[model samples]
Target: MSKEPLYSLRMRAAQGGAHEEGGLHISGGERLGFRDEIEALVSGLLRKALQHSRGDADFINLTIEKVEPASCRVLSPLPVSTYEVADAEEGRRQAAVLLRELSVSEQAIRNALCLLGSVNNLRGAVLLDSRSGERLDTRGERGIRVSRMDWDRERYLYWQNQHPLFGSPRIAEAIALATKVAYAPGTVAELCWSDDPEYVTGYVGSRRSGYCRITRLKEQGDFSGGRVFFVEPGTFISEYIVHLERTPVWIG
Candidate 1:
């Protein structure tokens, strides 16, 4: 296996490079060539760095030369930090990998990092785009949450009872606190987002029950179980602004 640091690997991936999933990965900037696209890559790298750096003072330099109005040249080696930042980040990454191998719950890892106190340095500004695999770099961003309504109460109950994230009673606490308005039994909360209205509704959310949930499950067999955390802010900024604006976050 390559001995390259995972951050280095991820940074390379962010910069229109290859990833483990496949090599056909093209960054949004590479495909669309927008300044925001490039900035998203930077933001994602920064977030990962912040997670690994554990709150060390750091800075990254990006040099871009315009090739044309639609595209630019990304000069190589946009080093985010030197010395302590890199070392500390490597330690954090090693810890995360080792802990995960031991079957530690993600919440446990996060809680341990929280006690370290530096991981909170992000200030709630990190936004990761799962579809495009990009991130927006900023302290303020529009955010969304998306989860398919396939997990019936039975699956939810099973997961809540058996899943590692649920091993801690704190998962219940977190879910309860995170859930804005608790749903009644047999009902579920849902949300969706889209960049274009034609592709999908700008935003859709509900707290009702119907057979449609089971129909969706029957339709998409692969996406059967998931607990999503966030959605791309740029694609759903309109909905995010109207209903789900974010506050500055230092602790979480």
Candidate 2:
């Protein structure tokens, strides 16, 4: 890839793709206020954001390359016997079987097979990473959810090590403050709890708190068994904590 500047607000309207290029109602006899209604909705959203943020505002930059709805159906629900297995290994085997039944991405399927990050945690529908979080998709009628993953070493390390969360009150407070400085509001983050145990542990957090509130516990351990994962409705990826799309911004 070549070095090029990524622009702000390069996004499309929620229903931008469905309309025609020469204005809406390609056929005649359409409602007059249709386009205006969309503009009003967008303006209202922006106003609310500005009001809530109180100054420091940034234009979210993204391009809608593709959008997919939770358009697949499962053949069957998980068997009740899966939760009753006694042995952990056996439990995982059964869960893996159930996971294979879900019509999600290969990554999500693989993670579920390995028992990563509450793979069983389904919200009636789930957003699986089919693309590198650069793609947006819908979860039933919920609308587009965004997904982005950060495997970059520099960002991930700094995210965890810089004034990292600890059990101490003062240290905890410091780490909390640092988290605010690190990421912006409405950002959902993946926080690790000390890389240990047999499996890699990860949990999700929102902008309201510096520390993750155990969206999925079992933090750090049994990772030798599999990777970590997070499940949710279509993700509304905020631009603040989002991964680097071009040159690294946080690092000098």
Candidate 3:
């Protein structure tokens, strides 16, 4: 079977006249324009749709229809005077309910983190100590110390068991805590490790280890996973971390 088109938005402007006055025609076509904003919007919409699907076979095969600005205006005009005001209000109400449901679930948070990580251009993950402070190397030394709190090991373990199909246990655990501790609007959590040749330890015969970072956390849920976490070499996010061989040097 042919793969679905990576993009699903096609804008066909009228032959002549201002785009707004003449109005633009949008088609749910396979071709997408080269504009950065358009591409980002398409990707964000697709990601959100997929996350809502949650591995369902039907949604996996579903396609998005084109959305038009004019249609949205007609359907949800300002000043609360549009004919579709009631319908628009109902849509908003339904959306609010769904948001409440998803935001409270830990799985939704992890999925969001994953989607966010995918869109980030950065290659490395940030490291933070248990206290939510950034963990950075100083003077070429490791083992940074910070405040200690009763780490919620059980909660982390629970998240790991729940998402076996997704991220590594250790990474999942980290993400779970990060979601509750370091989370902020539009921030995403990333799992990173020291894989640089310069950072590799001769004893392990590898140059890298594992770490995690929390980035943008947002409310729109436009990303694929509910909460997204970027993964890097030597630092696998969620499920990937579980696959690595056990090492005692790195403590949670």
Best-performing candidate as measured by TM-score: 2
Q: Write the residue-wise lDDT of candidate 3 on 99-218 in tens digits.
A: 233232344333322333343222123332212232322311111111111123344355446645434323332332233222222222322211111211100000111121212122
Query: How do the residues 1-252 of candidate 2 rate in per-residue lDDT, one tens digit apiece?
Result: 112321212122211122223211111000001222435434543443333211222332223221111221111111111034444444444433433333234455454333334332111112234222222324322222122111123433544464354333222222332233224332232222211242222222223332332212243333222122223334454342232121122110
Ranked candidates, highest lDDT first:
2, 1, 3
TM-score of each: 0.21, 0.23, 0.19
lDDT for predicted candidate 3 compared with the true structure = 0.25
Q: Which stretches of candidate 2 lie over 4 Å from their true place?
A: 1-186, 189-204, 213-221, 224-252
Q: Which ten residues in a row have the lowest lDDT in candidate 1?
A: 210-219
Candidate 3 off by > 4 Å: 1-139, 143-154, 166-169, 176-191, 194-252
- Model 1: per-residue Cα lDDT over 68-147, one tens digit each: 22211111111111112133344344444433443434554454333232221122222333233233323321122211
Which residue pairs collide, candidate 1? none
Overall lDDT per candidate, in order of appearance: 0.26, 0.28, 0.25
Whichever of 1 and 3 has more lDDT, that candidate is 1
